[model samples]
Target: MFKHLLPRMRERSAAANRPVSLSDMMEEFWREPFGNLSPLFRDAGYPAVDVSEADGVVTVKAELPGLDPKDVTISVENDALILRGEKRFEDEQKKDDYHRIERAYGSFSRVVPLPGKVKEAEAKARFEKGVLTVTLPRDAAEAVRNIPIEGA
Candidate 1:
């Protein structure tokens, strides 16, 4: 039935290099077979993100071409860092229409969980040259705690 057909369909899709249908995209979002695949497909045009941790700071940088800083939003809830933004496509109406449209538009979000608790007040973010940089300072006490060993 569908179980056998799914693999063949996937292989056909790969061979054709066609974009997955919107319904299939929704299904993948719900199943989350590969974890965070939604964002990857939703914002396929955007460059990959870079995350780094050093000492007590965590840095995340993402490339968002043609996106304005005002359209981007960054927030922290609990131990998760959330980045949300929109990429608007310019409207063009001409006698000669476009044959193909590939760039993605609309809202995108990326939620990254911190390795340890962070100082929300100290978190800083900057955007320049179509790149967004978010810096989160790790809470010192939460970063590491000495556990006293006792003889049993």
Candidate 2:
């Protein structure tokens, strides 16, 4: 009796593993039946981040869609860099206008620890096209030192 549905189920299972489509599948996998699932449908608040270090600086890039510069905050202390922001859902829908909605909205925070100390006063942050880029200049003196070694 369930033989006909096997192929369709298999197709969906296969699609869930595709790199680009895996996120959607994961979201759907957690959805509950016949309940208020608005929160679940909202965007995964955490943004994707990338970090790179060169010479005496570390660069971090975070993807924050539909966010204003003032809404985001970046800070570093004791070798730790933190990113925090809130995503608000301001859209209002009429009783008979919408069928399905899937966009995350809420407060999100991400903290990253740097491998070395940075010059707090020299840190820089920029926001463009929904991406936040932060550049932290390392303390040059703290990054290197000559230790005298006596032959044993």
Candidate 3:
């Protein structure tokens, strides 16, 4: 029944030096159906992100554990902040037997819409302790204006 996913599951089993069981294949079949439905879902595979604006500056933070700063790329395009990174699979040369592997290893991209106009040229990013913080100074000249309503 899980023929389509057998090869992929076999590779994972081989990587862990374990045999793939029928139950394991069934579990993977159920889990793969919800892939990338929405960023609102916690299992969407995208890193956790927080965005806030204060004092004409917009700050964005993303959690990226087990990733080097160089592996991540940040950019601003179409008034959105784009975060891209890859977490490579670690291959160990030890003789220890594996039990469970839950960490995700692959490339992920996240697009966050900016709250307002920002100076993309002056944007700054810093990575500290597996967290990436990006600061973007908002453009005051292009700030939104509230027009008074004359009549309905």
Candidate 4:
């Protein structure tokens, strides 16, 4: 019954640079019943992120729909900015039955590499609407350092 999905599983595994077992493929296949309806419905990767730097500030924006600000955790560690969060799905089905759940839910973590050193203590984050924006001011000293030239 699921023989047709093997090729797709292999492609997905190869994209991630890892091997996918039959059980793992089955689990993912069952997780989304209407996954092939459209690209929007497919779990192509959650919380799509964009990182940009300008005017001595590094900004990271992530799309996190249906998630509260409290559900997210932002931190800078090891020269990278880490974002961790979860999207919980609550179905209060009293009479209507769910035909499809296109929204991918569960916990997710995204690590963005910093363009330069940032002042961790001065970082600021704000969650407005479904977008999460994190602003990190670059460390003036570390961002640009000059070394004296010694002639041999």
> Clash totals for all models, in order?
0, 4, 0, 0
lDDT of 4 by residue, 36-133 (tens): 47885564455688889899999999998889999999999988999898888787677878888787888898888898789999999999998999
Model 4 stretches astray by more than 4 angstroms: 1-45, 145-152
| Clash pairs, model 2 backbone | 42-103, 42-104, 43-103, 43-104
Instruction: TM-score each candidate.
Output: 0.64, 0.62, 0.68, 0.65
The Cα local distance difference test for each model comes to 0.79, 0.79, 0.86, 0.84
lDDT of 1 at 36: 55
- Residues 41-147 of candidate 2 have per-residue lDDT tens digits of 55333778888998889998899989999888888876888898898977665555657768778898888878788999999999999999999998887877879
lDDT order, best first, reads 3, 4, 1, 2
Model 1 Cα shift for residue 128 (angstroms): 1.5
Candidate 1 similarity to native, TM-score: 0.64
Q: How many angstroms is residue 25 displaced in model 1 relative to the true structure, after the best TM-score fit?
A: 21
**Where does candidate 4 have its weakest 10-residue lDDT segment?**
36-45
Give the lowest summed-lDDT range of ten residues in model 2.
18-27
The TM-score leader among the candidates is 3
The candidate with the higher TM-score, 1 or 4, is: 4
TM-score of predicted structure 3: 0.68
